[model samples]
Target: MLTANAAAALLDTEAEAADIRTYLATQERKTLLRFLTCGSVDDGKSTLIGRLLYDTKLIFEDQLSVLEQDSKKHGTTGGDIDLALLVDGLEAERQQGITIDVAYRFFSTPKRKFIVADTPGHEQYTRNMATGASTADLAVVLVDARQGVLEQTRRHSIIASLLGIRHIVLAVNKIDLVDFDQQAFERIIADYESFVSDLDFSSVVAIPISARHGDNVTSVSERTPWYAGPSLIGHLENVEIGAEDRARPFRFPVQYVNRPNLDFRGFAGTITSGSIAVGSEVMVAKSGRRTRVKRIVTYDGDLASASEGQAVTLLLEDEVEVSRGEMLVTPESRPNVADQFAANVVWFDEHPLLPGRMYLLRTETEEVSATVTHLKHRVNINNFAHEAAKSLDLNEVGVCNLSLQAPIVFDSFKENRSTGSFILIDRVTNATVGAGMILHPLRRAANIHWQAMDVTKASRAALKHQKPAVLWFTGLSGSGKSTIANLLEKKLHAAGRHTYILDGDNVRHGLNRDLGFTEEDRVENIRRVAEVARLMVDAGLIVLVSFISPFQAERRMARDLMGDGEFIEVFVDTPFEECARRDPKGLYARALKGELKNFTGVDSPYEIPENPDLHLRTLGRSLENMADELESWLRERGYC
Candidate 1:
């Protein structure tokens, strides 16, 4: 009854649907690889990524047509088709003819799916490259054949290794410019291998190719007959990514406490390592509290088991003390639990890292106050040598010992990156200042414990019949901090009020004699004075700390050490010109003539208190009047 044409059309439609189903099934099973391109300025990082996308047939005809027009407008490639435009999508990057921000692209071959990051090549953009490298499994470190291995090449390689990128592809780009000479390629490879001998890359594969033109990129090139290595695409598709994370111990960082109802209290997080089943036992890595997983809950339903990278809500069979920022792991695989540790830090802030400054240490789910206790050494990128350094400047890498306010769960970066990595945030500005990777616990953190005392602060204050507080005096040099502090202490002593003055100059002569007047030393000076003042306050004495304390960061640190409402900031506001004119100790003259350094109001800066408890204008007020006013403030608040 049906015509031949109708029957043929129906059969063809059914065949097409079957083919589409098979293709989708195959695509879903393909493995994915994440990588990044990095090197020095104009080393073809972006161009290399663009070429990969193009040679893989990911670009469209319309895109190629517009690329021709953009090439003319940008003149980056002399009116030719600029393949780099495909990945360098930012208008600023195109205008400047360089990559600035990190650009990400996705493409796929029959064997694997790829996500590649095109990172900037300039030194200032090292942070951007680091951001890209943090998640990459492999790094395609491009090098110009003519220039050979450069400083940035070495720096990127070092960072890649530090970030745990085991596989490295050294794409010797612009090989055509070097006349496809095998000797030039071999020389660059020799230098790179020699430098990276100290690094921790599992494999280093060097290939010669011209990214601008399609030579040895997707297939073997006839020009490089001496080279026998696989093409870039071939090597990437065949590179074996280890399944180490799954084989290692299980680690689940509890992101949130999900208590949807009284009937269910589940711990929700993405399993960072290994696997967990419905009946598997997990222990609190820090506390060693054991519990069993009752159910592995997901949106799709309860899973019998879950592996690494899967987000699920785990219902425990027994009640346990678990909180956010804690890690649940295998019973036998307990992680390091300590408040003090050593780490490798990459400084990103323009403000140099002051050793004693308090910074916010932010891990995966925890944040605590931490300070760099010591700078062991800074690594010289050029020669991979260690050099002594007091502070870490921008783009500098150093190893430091850090002391945290509270202990948190962690593992060494080599074992588990998610739990082992952290970022240092400036407390005042909340700006991310540095990124650090934990090496190991300090061992002292475990041995030392706080000793309990029978005499408490409350008991001491009751015995003295007066409230203990810290009167923090801050001002420019010759601005009457010491003068006012000395007068206030005398008044308090006369009134039978126990008081002590930790004068800056006097303490430096004894407690801080080893410290210099450098910025780092100044921070340490304030830190030591703050600790002493805290102890004096604990002993029921009204502690008066007189220091310039020019930087706000240290002042805030000192203030944070005190109890709420117990720390009062007294600002002695003397005009800079007036303070310089007084020059009471002749120190200002020496400072102005370059004989002295780190002198507040001359070479160093003073950050005035924005909201001081007592603002005394020294331009007109006498010392006696100011001291009288200060004593009155204490009396009004019932301190004396």
Candidate 2:
């Protein structure tokens, strides 16, 4: 109905739109690679990433304009348009000219889509570097050519290797500063390769680059014409990272148990690895209960099959004992099941990681009360040597033996990172204190078993004509904890109830003779006494435990050992000034005189209980009255 030129124009517009759609579809199908840059301070990690974003033409005009203005104000390059401003997005980072946190950026070339994390280079922020490396497929470890093979550079490489990054690109940045000397580049690469030889990396390719000037970043640099190798982006676009995830065994860590209605029950989680199809049988990792998958329900509808990274609700053919913090895996290929294992742990807390102290170890599908039973060795990341260490300090990596309260399912980190990685949480603060990768299950864990006895705790209590309980009396020295506990035990014994007392100083002479007054020893002291108390309570005796028990973590661990409502935490509330003034054993005087170390209420800290079953104040109340009050409360609850 129109002129020939108008009709041709309309057809051309439709064709152009179709071509655009096709191009987008191709881009969507391009393979995606996630990687991170890490190394020593001033290694140009941020600048290298900024160069990638700029060279790939991923920046908008407005962002470029803002960056140019920011370059004049905060850039380190003396009014030049500093490319690092593109990635150092934080105001603090720009002001300090340092990356304090992990800055993630996404960009793409025609051949591949990429996600890059620019990690901090400082030793204190090494935990942040480990976090960024946890999920990366490759690591571009930037090294300043002027400062070759620094300690932080080696440390980051170790963490990257530990976090399952098999491929590495050793980017010797700032090559221009050294006049692009081929010998200097080779020397740096040689030192780095020798240091990381034991890390078990599949590949390590070195490239000389100048991130600020964009040489050997996106394309070949004329300045480094003597070096013959693929540029950073060229190698990244062509590297072949296998689909190892889909090839591994099926592992679905159930995040939530979905029960929306009476008729429907489903386990909802993301498939961490491998493929799962409808009608495939899966087993609960810990329980070994197998069931056929009836449906793979997604928001869009039912899927016949689901692979790694897909979030869906899986309906089973039968109702199995599946819950949150459990895993559903292929029945034929089960993960390891053990309560004790050796792991490589990197401590992140300001407080050191003490052996035998209880922590909450949380894996992908399980959280359990665990302890570092032994500090095998600490890694000297500088030279890849193992050194003996009593505890793991901040940013320290150690191979340690961990024993859990119950068995969990996991694979070796080398076999599967998702199922093997875990984080340690402080019981009191609930903060993540450390990260670990499972090495292998200890033999003792698999060999030891709880041999059932004919006489149980209930039977013992029934024969004694009373209920068993652990009366944990905790306070500072000279706070009347032992005095009140002794009085309470005498009253119970006089009333014909079974009773026993585990005094702290008395146990140290026999049971805990080898331990010292260190913080770690104090934790061990409480653990041993709590175990004895539990055994006594199981033998039909009301066990009264009197100790300083300074840390709340150990107290909570002791409480966790007892059955529900069986452990009563009785806090003896007395002022530190009063305890110090009393100085019943002259311990505070010794501590104040710098003779005693780690003595509670003097040199050491005592974390007061947040909530206790009984709080007895010694300011006005007499010891006899406090003892009677505790006994009367127990009688009211029918515990005695």
Candidate 3:
């Protein structure tokens, strides 16, 4: 226990400390601008930020003293100012003289406050650049005056646009080395402006400066009399950023369910759009389930409501089936559910993206299998033209069609980040291979009645036959699979079992002839064929499909669309030697000529089925015996 005088003195100290904290919080809350400084290597990104802090006198005496001491210890010349020493203080960064990670610095000016994200300028660290730009409101893309605009410079510009940053300030650094020529600055300005004219940036400001000599940084300089713009820091303090209006669709992708104890259950995520209040009705996308918000919780405490730009936890009145991947949005402004969309893609892998291969797509918290439908065109960065192209290799930018396994709820990337952006993961290595933005959902204009008629085209003939409906066939290629399918179709016609052989080759001649043999393309071909087969099955006709449907994943996907008894798999178990001897199309010979790549049973691997509903040895057995065996199998299955 303290005496009366001692206790009173302790109370006084506590009050003073509390007063100081209140003042700081008030100052921080007044800040609204968040920007990042990014550019090529040694282009003065860190030095520029350091000069802003140092020139403003924001650095404390102790910190400045330590910087001066370190400068002398490291033997860095130039009046012991050592601006780079403040940011590039890490031992590894100092030794390598390159920024490796995103470094955040916060400081306040009299006019406005700022938070600068200094990102690495290297090409391979595009993922790191993305991480820093993920939360920035503006970006200051630096270009060395001597080097003009390099590949990484264009790449950073593209990324900034993709990340939905509103403002871009092109800082022409190291102007002193270029004699501060006004013509040089104009040339660069005109070139870059023309390049990014189509990009969706609200504002773009160009400034010429020398970060090393403090020219045009903190105040006006005599070096460039032709330049009449505000100083670097002056523009940053006055740059008009359009504030986010959260009056649009409410989107909350549940990142985590905060279950601290049995009594507490809250949904936590960073709000991407609109607002939510207590008792506000919201619907979970896809499921279309509706619920009311019980309470809006925050890190500080429970609140009456929450708005966009604020990360908070939500409590619902009912324990709905909400998960991390599912999106919570207002029903009034719900997004479209689409399985296919067009997207602008940036490919970053060594191998080119081919059609038919499967990649895992992660949009917000949701991950699904996706395939590139087709490469529309490659972007010519130098002139900004879309060249007709078939594929995109490493470090290439292009537009393409992306087909997802399931329909996803999303908005255009221009409208919302939380529901727009997604990452593509390679299925084999699980690496993030590409990044994409949804352009538009694909739409096919056809009436439901028309589709119903297409399903009934062959149903009348099948019912007239005394046999039970149709015959279903399946197997791999180069195994006399199609020949057997043709023979069986003829036999079924003669026996009066209404059947249609949807031979893979015959259908490809019309529906899928434009498709290729790439892994990505092959999957799409199968998906389209499977949909057609399901429609035929609905018409009460047996659809026989004989294609090299390699993967079990693809086969399972096809089987899911039809009823249990509607689809059947027939295995054509034939030796490679016999099939090669009877090679009808000379495809096996072409595989041996090195003319084909990714050929199953040649260069690429093939997966044989472990079990099938009907198995047949097509090569050695007589055609009559094979037909008899098929008739009995159909009889057992009630098809004949």
Candidate 4:
């Protein structure tokens, strides 16, 4: 080398050139695209992503060397570099040769920067797929040329549509395996278009490509002369994902109340949609109180205005009451505020979703107790048909009526994704069991309100000599529950106690006539009957409910509806064999012959009470004796 000064100058020049190159690269990646690749297992989704990364020169030299070595050692491409190995980073995935979790990759080209989500293909991981699609602006659904359209493909398409993904690309992968047949590609395209006609998508383009051979991915392939469409990478780079959110109304859900000092108080949250200025008039959705925005506080001092995707704190001119879970929106265009709404839900729990069970409904920054009041129908992914469904199992999509404990602000999922999506969490386990998109708020919820009356339940109960109570009888079918309840009601009636008996079969003829013997229907049947009994108890009556409430959870629900010490669970304990032998109405015989489906003691399950207030061994005890025991207990409790 020459002198040390000359060498230093040369090094500085190289450094400046590198910095200039980096700045130009960053400037080139001005536009950002978030998309997801989804398809069935072995559909070459990861391979397509790998091909994009490799062909664009995004892979490092040393990483490529290691990949070449790994391909020689354990590649599935028969000694060629397995492109899937580039993205399947999990050990379990590499061992099983299947993607289990969503693998995210970031890469940029001359036109735009891309964040690609490679979602799993297994049906069990449908929740993971939903999570990935929830934030994606476009979806690239891959299909194997040999298999054409499959059930998993339809399922993913349905989910993508439900998630409001407007742009879709049907990548007919592995075209070379079929000798670059244009007819096969056309057939697949026709099948897909015909099936997807019902879905709501802005545009759907079908492109034939070979991800393994890097044909028609980043560059036009010479093999596919019939395919006039742009390559996959070219389409992704140029597709205009519209900025529709800018035109939508503003919505900001307050996540935290920021009180840095006594003088400074602000509501902090991310702007979900539209834009907000410092002097904009905002309304608290829940309270409907109007106020003016005073300041927009951020980490970089303060902002005069905040737009969608910006997280900032807002200070209001008026000291209006605000809390977490409250939403700030333009008063002129407020979202719907209601407790009852209809939503499309994807059930992800192993246990099927039954109506009337309480779950934690969590949205952006709010959580409320909610119940799936009714399941409208389940969507069949294979044919896009709606079928009657009482409950939703794992990986099933259904439209349901939800009842929330409190009103929340929301928009139709089609209008805004941030304010319209929510997840159901299991109350006991705190596990996410379902994902739902709000369709619309039910009109009845807003129209009807609980009218306050001078004559309350307490006043009605005080009018009667005894306290209002619900004596619920539960056991297997033909377990003498009805007979024992009738005798107890008569005994209480003779003792001048205001008692009314709500027998299961008698009430089924009128109130619960629409219900069937299915587990979901049974749960609803119990719910309706319990509400009626609660109303009767509020009318100052000692209600005796006799039903074969087989499920312990349902009995607990009824118990929870009553006041403390007001519900007395009477377990009519009779063995299944004993109940079947004593089937007076021939129900057990019909159920055994498969004529009566979902008949308890034959096919359906009956959960026994772990701890009942009164346990009567009906095998050895008479109905009159059991009634006397209940009457004695009531007398001791001063209810008679």
RMSD of each: 2.0, 1.9, 6.5, 3.9
Report backbone clashes per prediction: 0, 0, 7, 0
Q: Give candidate 3's whole-model lDDT.
A: 0.77
CA lDDT of each prediction against the hidden true structure: 0.90, 0.92, 0.77, 0.91
lDDT of 2: 0.92
Structural similarity to truth (TM-score) of each candidate: 0.96, 0.96, 0.72, 0.88
> Compared with the true structure, what per-residue lDDT tens digits does model 1 show for residues 35-93?
99999988898888878998899989999888888888874777568989887788899
lDDT of 3 by residue, 1-640 (tens): 9999999999999999999999888786775678888867777888788888888888999998888887775524456576777787678776666777788888777778888888888876666677787778899998899988777788788778877898999999999999999988999899889889988888889999988789999897899999999898889888877465445689998889889999888888978889889999989887898999998888689888888778898888888888787788999988766788888787767766765556788987788878787789888766667898767777677888887877777887777766887888876557788878777776641111233354353455357543223233445457766766777777777876666677777878989998877766677778788878776666666567888777654665566556666667777777767766776788878887998777777776566666676788776687667766776777676665
Name the candidate, 3 or 4, with the larger TM-score value.
4
Q: Answer with 1 or 3, whichever has the higher lDDT.
A: 1
lDDT of 2 by residue, 208-263 (tens): 99999999999999999898999999999999885666579999999999999998
Per-residue lDDT tens digits for candidate 4, residues 83-158, read 8989898888888888899999999888888999999999999999999999999999999999999989999999
- Which is superior by lDDT, 2 or 3? 2
Candidate 1: lDDT of 408?
90
Off by over 4 Å in 3: 1-12, 39-113, 120-124, 219-222, 246-249, 255-268, 279-292, 298-300, 311-332, 337-340, 354-358, 371-375, 401-405, 445-511, 516-640
